[model samples]
Target: MFSIVEAIRQRATPQAVALVQKDRTLSYESLFQQCDALAAMIQQHVPHDPARVDRLRIGVHFPSSLDYVPLALATLAAGACFVPIPDELADEEKRDLATRTGMDAVLVLETLAGWLPEGTQKLGAFSVAEQKVLIQRLPAVTPGFPAAAFEGINPAFIRFSSGTTGKSKGVLLSHESLLERITAANEGLRIGPGDRVLWVLPMAHHFAVSIVLYLYHGATTIIEETHMGEDLLRAGAEQKATVMYGSPVHYRQLVEAPPVGEWTTLRLAVATAAALDAATAEKFRARFGRDLVQGLGIIELGLPVLNLTGAQEAPEAIGLPLSAYECLLKDDTGREPPAGEPGEICLRGKGMFDAYLDPWMPRAEALDAEGWFTTGDLGRRDAAGRVTICGRKKTLINVGGMKVFPEEVERVLDSHPKVQRSLVEARLHPLYGEVPIVRYIASPEGAPTTMELRNHCRAHLAGYKIPLLFSAVPQLPLTASGKLKRA
Candidate 1:
């Protein structure tokens, strides 16, 4: 299979603007040239034999910056696997990932020196020194998993799950999978050369489908470094961005008061990484006159479902499966659920993930005989065929055999003007198997009292589904992808 860099290069023109960050601009031609240069630099440090099965793996430990894009592309272009080590990770977490991936080297800038965990040597080069980047060598360790088998797939990227509800596993993707998913996703997004996408999500979490897709389709990407409402609005307006790809948190903050001025250029806004509450959708529609198209974007499957058909009418739904994918709501017996009933969401499509890295499970083992991958999400489809996510299957609360989807309860609590966000977890109980307890972050105006929250839930939720306790916390934890962490 050909490299992703080759696909991007075929569509690039010397004068075409590919990326914009603040005042800096990178032309498409220059981007490809820089990638090749960096790839050569990395190869000098970690040489390769084209015939070898176990290829080099390089971890990129950079922040969300312009340089990050080129660095990742370079790794893939060099015929090595690209792994992202999120900067938000603690030192121990960082060290654990390095060990788990069996990465030969980590690329870091000199500005962030002396921060990495021990057992790294300097593998410096003149070209890398010019950019203040260091190739930190890691101790060689024999991988417990099948490294040769993993490398046989022409792997391009490896990113770990957030471990939000369970133990995290490294998700692996090959160059071919990336290309296929981008093709499938664009059949819905319809992103073209004229489109300018405004991006605020971290590059580490979003690059596989987002940045790579835009570049492959010859679309310009305007990077908004700051998520501040005013800053985002200013950048979107100044850059004349036509599309916005961000998380639900970014959309919610933009709808808040103090009125960040308008950017009339936006025609489409996609909210992912978390559930988009109905309240935020209505407010965003009123303020921006554009629907917040909620989509289900999993690492395993790129963009299988999008709210293109019912964004305005059924804002809570994640729309239908894309043309290239088939989504199923299967009960425990692996049959379709009763009409209007919820079940575990399963998908059959092209571009599914290749393997689980740490445990070394192949895609053939991950999928069933029918080629369906069971997503842990519990979802229901309406008469219109639009699917709405109920909650995680593992996160469903069992209160004396009564089912409680935490998302259902949290949706009611989030509608309160005085609450920012909340988490509902199962707690032990004498009469019931477990009861839901809420830990929340209150708005600046102060939390509505316990009675107020309970009354609100009572109005919207079933009596059994209402949380038993409400405790305010300074903040809730978020995964590297900017979604709430259930674990």
Candidate 2:
């Protein structure tokens, strides 16, 4: 089985730029050395029971800085699973995660030192001066210990699903699973050396975590402290970034903003986390002279499918499945649906997570037998093998006897000029079982009344498909990964 730590060691070289920030850059060699030093420091101070050492779970609390990378590498190097606690999470949520994961220790930055639970061992931030002191003050631990060996099925990382419907569940990912999934994505996307990537999304999200596959291919990654539109465009030009990935929100801003004609180094742009509207996609392509590849992957299945090179073949499609993944759209009876028939999306592949951690207090059922993970997304495949997502299964609204998909209504609402963003949710109705309601964010200095929105939808949708109520809000509640939360 491949070890993530060993992969880093072999790949590290002085000439390879592994990390870049606003003011500084660290080569692969420096990154590896820092990780090694921190690994030794952790080994020296943390008590390890021989029997439990191999299964140690370590919680990490740090910002997306240079130090965070090495610390994460060191955790894996020390034969432990690293759980990243995003700084934006509430204090109670952080503690709850650490407690639920049964983390042996919490490695925290100085700024978050007080947030850790009592009795948790903390690792101080390693500065140049602190590194020297750690090496001098702490006794040297064994440096040449054999790296942890495991089967291909051994769990590597336990990522929690964004708790949109309920409490979060930990999704266990194995070494071979992640490696194969990422390799397939890298190959399919054609990411390679010399390709500079501007990473602005939160690292905690699987979308950002998938970038590690690019690093393995010798691509350079530039981390941005903030994700403002102008800052991202400026950094892309400054870093000569070739590949950029973000949500539709980011892409909408980029295409709508002032033109940057000279920023031509960008060759590939990817948008995920939510569906990319066709109109917006066309606008982006018209401005950049390059089509934005819309990637289709679920958190439960890692990033097994991509629509990179073949997006233009089917403008409304969500690309083809990755080489390692086998996808099937099945009806309620578990029978395969004919082409163009909408059904639940099912996947069986190496990229699929082993199991979801039980979130209920006493632990509850998470996965079913046969290992076919059912992604609750409703979609259909065309004759040419292109997948077009229709709506979410749980987000369907039942108006009397008719079934209404909120996404269909939301898409129409979003197309309006006065609507900045919109969400369609099912609300309980007295006569009808449930009716669809429209909530939207208005464009700057622009507000459209309920009747205007209704008229806009009436032009595109049937009578039953139209929302019964319209509400305007500044912003809709979203999960950490930016997916719309089901009401």
lDDT of 1 at 6: 90
Against the correct fold, how does model 2 do in TM-score?
A: 0.86
Q: Candidate 2 residues 175-287, lDDT tens each?
A: 66667667767766777777888887777664224546756777778888876677777788888889888887788777776545346899988888778878778887887
* lDDT values, one for every candidate: 0.86, 0.70
Candidate 1, after superposition: displacement of residue 430 in Å? 3.7
Stretches of candidate 1 off by over 4 Å are: 49-52, 113-115, 125-131, 257-262, 442-448, 473-482
Top model number, lDDT: 1
Q: Over 4 Å off in model 2, which ranges?
A: 118-125, 128-153, 207-209, 359-370, 417-421, 428-432, 440-447, 472-476
410-461: candidate 1 lDDT, tens digit per residue: 8889889999989998998999989999999999998899999989999998
Estimate the lDDT of model 1.
0.86
Residue pairs in clash, model 2: none
